[model samples]
Target: MKSLCRIGHSLHSRGLTFGSSGNISVRLPEGGWIVTPTNVAMGDLDPSQLSLLDDDGKWIDGPKPTKETFLHAAMYGARRDAGAVVHLHSTHSVAVSVLEDIDPADVLPAITAYYVMKVGALRLIPYFPPGDPALGEAVAGFADKHHALLLANHGPVVAGADLRSAQYAAEELEETAKLFLLLQGHKIRPLTASQAAALKQ
Candidate 1:
């Protein structure tokens, strides 16, 4: 709980999350999960009030989970190794999501080795209204192959083997997005496909 709170505060303080624009979840080893409640600022998550769910993803205790809870649930369902998930309406990532020319299959270029290593190939999930089941389904379809996804016109969602891993990957994604935006309209040299594949390997 403390770790989750710390991440929430870090994200908010660093401007990755503004207002209540993000949701986070961590899978419990025994079963089920804990997720941040809806409409609460990530900077102010209260550990005692975190929502708890059963293996089925039903809210069993504490406040109601994020309306976007399905996103987290979909990720967990698709990736057994994903111990935590972080979804954020971060600035640069959202900016990149709305770009007309980005490839939906892999939204970000392999601009840096750390970005390639931490986020791998970032996919795009088509736009859907918040809480829409279709969004969850879209995420589920891609979650199996990619741990990081950019929600069309929304933001990014990332999953990792643990909370810290997820958090770091999410941060790395936002930084990469910022870098991508800065380099637009300029001659650029992204790592070759071979280079990116090597990092993944």
Candidate 2:
């Protein structure tokens, strides 16, 4: 448990994550989930501070879970293939959220082969107040078509088959967001639809 907790925070100190702004959860092999507690910095997670919730989203045991628990619950419900969910407020991604007058539907592109293959597709969900149920709707809107999502004014969230994969995807998002920022002044060529499809194959 401590090990998992550290992975959450390490991303913060390393500058890939920050601001008590992210949450991580794993579906225990037996059942239920182990989630980071609310308002606690990911870097500061303690085993005792972790919350356990039943599959129904009820507190089976442990401290109070995050108010955003519903968002996590929505992911679990929408994605049977997901074993872990990680949410992050990485700086560059949040920064990109407000820049580049790109269309909402096409915010994510196959600009990089790695992003195309690793993330498949990225969706942008409209902003909702933190801890609001509306966030679940924004997230759910993209769940059927995307594994990664950028919250309008918030951050990014991803569901992976496992924790490592989830973390990796989160890292990839930050990298791409950084690229999106750095390339702001340049002419960029997005991957053609056929090229994007080839990578999917």
Candidate 3:
């Protein structure tokens, strides 16, 4: 819980999230997860008020889980290795999502080795209203093969082996998105498929 609070504070302070616009969750060792509560500012998450869900995703205690709980559950259900998930309405990421002609299979190019390593391939989930079950299903459809996804006109969803990993990957994604936009209209050289594959291995 303290860890979640710390990361939440860091994300909020850094402007990664604003006005209760992001969500995070970490799987519990015993079972289920500790999730940020609904409609609460990430800057002010109380440890005791964090939502707790049992293994089946039933709310066991604390405040209500983020309405996007289905998003987290979908990731966990698809990827057994995903220990944490982070979803954010970050500026750059959301900007990229709305851009036309971006590939849905893998949105961003491998701009940096760190980007390739931390957030390998990013799939684009089609637009769906917030809290829509179809959105969750769309995420699940790609979660097994992808640790990261960008929702159309929404933002990014990233899963990692642990909370910090998820957080760092999410930050890396935002930074890469910023770089992608900055380098537009330039003759840029993103890593080739072979190079990116090597980093993944």
User: Considering every candidate listed, which one attains the maximal TM-score?
Assistant: 1
Give a tens-digit lDDT track for model 3, residues 53-107.
8866778899888999989999999999999999999999999999998999989
**Candidates, ranked, lDDT:** 1, 3, 2
Question: Candidate 3: lDDT of 130?
Answer: 90
Model 1 CA lDDT for position 102: 93
Candidate 3: residue 41 lDDT (0-100):
93
Prediction 2 global C-alpha lDDT: 0.81
Q: Model 1, 82-163: lDDT tens per residue?
A: 9999999999999999999999998988999999999988999999988898999999999999999999999999999999
Better of 1 and 2 by TM-score: 1
The regions of model 1 sitting more than 4 angstroms off are none
Q: Please write out the lDDT profile of model 2 over residues 3-53, one tens digit for every residue.
A: 668788788789876667788988888889988888888878897889999
Clash count in backbone of candidate 1: 0
- CA RMSD per model (angstroms): 0.7, 1.6, 0.8
Q: Candidate 2, which ten residues in sequence have the lowest lDDT sum?
A: 100-109
Considering TM-score, where higher is better, how would the candidates rank from best to worst? 1, 3, 2
Task: Assess every candidate by TM-score.
Answer: 0.98, 0.92, 0.98
TM-score of 1: 0.98
